[model samples]
Target: MEAGEPTSLQIEKQSLHDQVASRIRDLIIEGHLEPGSRIDEAKLVEQLGVSRTPFREALRTLAAEGLIVIRPARGSMVRKLSRADVFSMLEVLAEMERLAGRTACERASDSEIAHARDLHERMLEYYRSGERMPYYKLNQEFHTFIASLSRNETLCEIQGNIMARLKRIRFIGNSEPEHWRAAVDDHEEMMDALAARDGQRLGDIMAHHLSETWQRVKNVI
Candidate 1:
């Protein structure tokens, strides 16, 4: 066997768990599985056509990411982040994005910045066509790209976790026309800052952008 190779059984298990997790994640983010509601493992397993083992493994993974809560006897429920909890999460996310912006500005290669611009342009096209879902997904991709530009895997992973936790609220915000337009405008400014390699400016812009996002989602939270 080759060094560092995963056995077929291990690979199959990982694939099942990951697929289960992704399905549940989309359900949560799309609000099909409401927050604070108990997850019906039997029903979900039947509906998703998956077995109990992978379903349970997926629940554990979501719990670690703050998307689900496991209680003694009560079983697993979709986590409901309180207003305070939401704000605290946003605060940390804001700082993480600020750091990402600053670091990317300082260290991102020209090709990286160009790639970001390309993403922004594609996102703008979606916005222009009034394709809300595609625009929203591209918007997230654009931010994730910026986080990658920081060249810090730990920071990127932290950003992913927080974003995943807040994704439901974020989607609601983007569905609003006013907030959606404002978010697109912020992305434009972010691109400009990145183009100029202005770390401080990009950081400040990211902080403000996050604040606006919080405001937009405050009603839902």
Candidate 2:
């Protein structure tokens, strides 16, 4: 390698820790790392090709996020979710989303609302095309655009955390055609409420919409 040139190996190593952390987080969120399963740090370190420092750092980060529990002797384990945990999280997210939706109804400019409508239409087209991946991506974008329009940084952060935890369960629910259609309809209703600037109606709809989702996915979880 020439001077000032970044060797492939050097670049890879520099970002290896972040890569490892992201992979671990994905596994946890996807249920590949089951709740309460002991994380074998030694094996993970070997597999990730990083030293103890970065591996431990990743563990600490996850623990801080309430995704992992670090015990004195048992090392690290994935955090287990009880029914109460599920309900409590869903309730909190529902309220946060309601706040976002209400704020968006008041604060979103005409162009922003139109963009969301366009995304929704595109999402429906993707669904009709039977390409699940594209549909899911657009669905995420639709929700994210609404959240962005709320202009509440704190609410956006909270919604992101809630969505991350729910992603795995959402995948399961999306596998059912009935749930998929219902989810599309819900999005449409949400968009309608936002377009009308109906803050109270939007809040009610958002809360109920999330509640229904939790009801559908809780059994699978």
Best by lDDT: 1
Superposed on all Cα atoms, the candidates' RMSDs to the truth, in angstroms, are 8.2, 7.3
Query: Per-residue alpha-carbon lDDT of model 2 for 1-221, expressed as tens digits?
Result: 22432223222463455666666776675566777789888766755667888778888777766778889877999887776777888899889878888899989999998998899889989878876657866776777678888999988888877776555555556778888888878888887898899977887887887788778878766
Runs of candidate 2 exceeding 4 Å displacement: 1-16, 49-51, 114-145
lDDT by residue for model 1 (35-113), tens = 9989988877766777889889999999888899989888899999898988888899999999999999998999988
Q: Would you give me the overall lDDT of model 1?
A: 0.84
* TM per prediction: 0.84, 0.73
Error of 2 at 94 (Å): 1.4
User: Which window of 10 residues has the lowest lDDT sum in candidate 2?
Assistant: 2-11
